[model samples]
Target: MMIGELFDPQAPLAISEHYRPHWSQAGAIVFITFRTADSIPYEVLQRWEREKNEWIARNTGRNADWRKVLPELDPRLRHQFKKTFNRLREDFLDTCNGKCVLRQPDFASIVADSLSHFDGKRYRLGDFIVMPNHVHLLASFPSEETMIGQCDSWLHYTAWKINQQLGNKGKFWQQEPFDHLVRSPEQYQYLCNYIRDNGTKANLRSGDFLYRQHDNHQ
Candidate 1:
């Protein structure tokens, strides 16, 4: 979408730094991360996921198309479906977990499921890796809709599943997430490497991605 537009070199900053309004120019691969409040470890998320998967197996006949699974159910359930996702993010976490944020592996299953469910929809997924404490996503904004909107839906759907298992309410992810606009092939390659490596290049323990950054060549 931002193919020919000029990019502002001064827009990217960590949350510890002041917030600024900037997304990478069109056709750029942005590396983004969102951590739980207080930087809790994301590793413990797996401990809570098995229960949720078991519930789905019992209720949904083991496996079913996600888009078709719930809309036909009770109206309240439909409401829950819509309520779980967030635009810039999905959940708010309690800081009691640990120092390192634990990444939920369940989210990978959820991401695959949702992507399949929305296959024909107007969305494009770049590269992504779910770590114990954070996520690295390299996605392209669909020209048909807002990038944040699509991201919100995916996150909410996953969070909804988690919430259903936990039987608790409130936020699951921070409201603000880091986003970047890719401006050059170099930057795109840099982010693609980072996402695939999921910060491993910097000694960060995450799922190694190693995906091709071909989107940059386009």
Candidate 2:
């Protein structure tokens, strides 16, 4: 198995926007988080967005594009903002909100299988965990388009399969996922630890989640 590469600041970075910004670097390992559609309540997510926008307006400027301004801020400020946002979301997700069907081993296995199906072909899959309502993983893609396409493929296929098992339809996974390019070896180790400890952090029992670290990930 090929080891993943860290993000190179000097390399050309690809930025794309949907509900949020996505930064991609070819062959760079990325830490990604995607949750079930109902993992977070709509009102709560809206409020968080409103607060974030307000903060941006106050700190940067009114009508400022956060996507553009955020990366230009001082490293400390940027890190603080990212840290706070992630902590808040992580805390909420740990609450095991919504139906949390992924808590079921069979349902969670469907996601595990889907994630690993293209492991070494499309991307180098690393550590990943299936939480009650969300998932976290590390992978490196050959190109930005491949990364985005594979994510879509994983979500779409798993949603179809899981929903089919339940005999229900509608949105399964959240439309937009949170992804970040790994910038250093330290950060990569941090993410691996995060995935490994997530279940315990959530106070979940063994059967409540599925965690996997590829043998060659290290």
Candidate 3:
């Protein structure tokens, strides 16, 4: 018996449909992407970032210019810009309306909060990045606790939190998630690159850069 073998030889092979890392061994590095149910324009995200940057610059007194004026912008304008921006951006990316990652404050926050479920229960979160539309994460757990059911629970719980915050009333995420067991150093590096580059896609990375990485330990 190997440390990472979950499939049965007698069963039919089903690979392309989804990626499921065998968790019998050290653990796996999972790359999960969650798009909006109908590709809603999430321009509010980018606009918010720009505003935040301007505010940071002003508060820090970093060679002020128009930024000095930015801080004083009327609250009404700020709200209006966020509202219109979101309609222009996320509306296009909110495909499926099921997993509207952009609908949330920071897609990463959804995953981070979901970790609470396993806080004192089971499993541990590893490295992760939350892009506009998806997330790449490394999670570890005792072999016994790594059952597929638990995976669903984690994702499902996160979706609920995200939907509640976004004032959504339907499915907030895709049903299936991609997973891959961390087998070798090369594989780990490859995954890390993919996660970090997630923002460059000109798509979901459209969200907040407030990405956070859980420790890479058990």
Candidate 4:
């Protein structure tokens, strides 16, 4: 039932960049979202990426290093950018794109089990849901490395198992997941509510998605 601590702005933060930048704070609760590789259409993703790059260039100047530009933005502007970026993608996810194999109870169960495997030992598991084509969860890791490593472990294991079940090959998950450190109690509760309500918002029927929340919180 440990929700962990909120992020401290003064504390040292870790920034990891791949296709996008990920910010991590040791011991702070984080909300994460990862989707199937085919969840978003290629054209749609390409367009989104183009628009994002354009926005970055307009705001931070042409060819500005995203790694530095993002972290250096005004807090309000950064929040605005992130909110819009996430919202557009989330709206598309709600359309239930891709094969949505996870809609099957058996496939979804594999992911739920993988996420719970190391619960308290490696990181504190919080509210999580296995959606049709994506997953959303909250957890706190002992260190920034643990957070990144655990996310990879979960993605790798679940993808392998699920792919084996389907006799399919190749990538199962999108390489980079979207993650954010919990900034305050309000934001933590907001994420909890978001997880709880995602299925309904996506119009997924009962048994089409798997949702779990701590009993203490409910």
Candidate 5:
């Protein structure tokens, strides 16, 4: 199927819901963010969890329409559901919670290697940055198989290797990652900027952050 058709808004999407709903579309450009296990503060996470539950309560069931649901929701609730997520993410990431293991040069290199290991093999990687507590990436998956399998592989392998290096067997990352489909050129550029500026925004030192993008070299 054509990438555009695969991501048609009207087309039925295979969504996996845990704390947040994950939309999977074959052959789509995606922006993904995943964080270390303790990246979010406990109080912030508790509030986020409560808000997510409330959102699910408002937008549950198979027949619910996203387009209409937002319009119908209370203005304040809609703002939380639609608007504040970015702020929330930025706030949490800025907190720099957890061990900040990626601050270590070796650990950060492992993550960078893991992210680049499948470039051009599983997906066409555009831009990515490894932050101290979290990572952001923009890439295009060539197929459903590549999207599902390779994403899991990257995360699993990185967590395992990082854990081995840290000598801790506990969870290395948060289970759920944030993913958004990039459907337009404008949105694509926005994500590129987001990834590029993440380190600066988070006040990361040069050695603590690794950023690579196709546009910069070319």
Candidate 6:
């Protein structure tokens, strides 16, 4: 149930396949970054998809053995790949897409309420900023049993509610979200700082981003 168990060199870690490797552990604090459907430029997304597919093919070679090979891979290489990809993605999100619907106060308020609806119930929510086209959150699940399901439910409901408000049947958010487990207090604090300053970095006005927290603030 601890983050240490997930990072132990000798231990077998649980990983899920996504755009990148997703590592999960029971009762861990995780930082999540998700964006709207139009958040990334089409060209950038196409390139990212191609690169990721090539990396997967090189590493796993169209086989299930990738699971076995994952843990044996060098940690530094994996960390660097993830870090570089995140930086690129964040940079893309910074450029203003004037069509950002969440910039509207009403739409932003909807997302904020959706995020906090299950606070202290499904997960202990931490500091979260609802930006114009994306959101960053620090959430710790009550247990591993509920991690994936609860996470999916939160995204699904929030997207549904937002779409309803928009009166469109189209997608509201991206299909894949970036999730990283906070391995240390230092990492957690860094994520907190990042969320707090996300608006400034994106050149957002004061009213553009909304942050909500309860007593369980990070």
**After superposition, which runs of candidate 3 have C-alpha atoms over 4 Å from their true positions?**
1-107, 116-121, 144-147, 201-207, 216-218
Question: Candidate 4 on 1-218: residue-level lDDT in tens?
Answer: 44788999999889866632288888999999999999999999789877877788987675764445777888887887788888999999989999999999999999999999998899999999999999999999989889889998999999999999899999999988988888878888899999999999998898999999965583
* Model 1: per-residue Cα lDDT over 1-218, one tens digit each: 22222234564422223332134333334545655443443444443344344444465565654445554656775554444432213233312233332344454455446634553354445566554445556555433134555556756775677567657566665545676555676676666665565445435434422223334344
**What lDDT would candidate 3 get against the real structure?**
0.50
lDDT of 2 at 61: 76
TM-score of 6: 0.80
Which digits, one per residue and each the tens of the lDDT, describe model 2 over residues 32-110?
A: 9999999999999888887777777886675665666787888887887788788899999999999999999999999
Q: How well does candidate 3 score on lDDT at residue 213?
A: 48
What lDDT is reached at residue 127 by model 3? 55
For model 6, residues 1-218, the per-residue Cα lDDT tens digits are 22222234344446777632166666667788778888876888789866755665675564334335445558875675567677878887878563788888888888788878877777777788888888888777655556677667767887888788878887777877888877777777777788888889888898988876435443
Query: How far does residue 59 in candidate 2 sit from its true spot (Å)?
Result: 4.1
TM-score of each: 0.51, 0.91, 0.51, 0.91, 0.79, 0.80
Clashing pairs in 4: none
Instruction: Give residue 93's lDDT in candidate 2 (0 to 100).
Output: 97
* Per-candidate clashes, comma-separated: 27, 0, 33, 0, 0, 0
lDDT of 4: 0.88
How well does candidate 1 score on lDDT at residue 32?
A: 55
The runs of at least 3 residues in candidate 4 whose Cα sits more than 4 Å from the true structure, single-residue gaps closed, are 19-21, 54-69
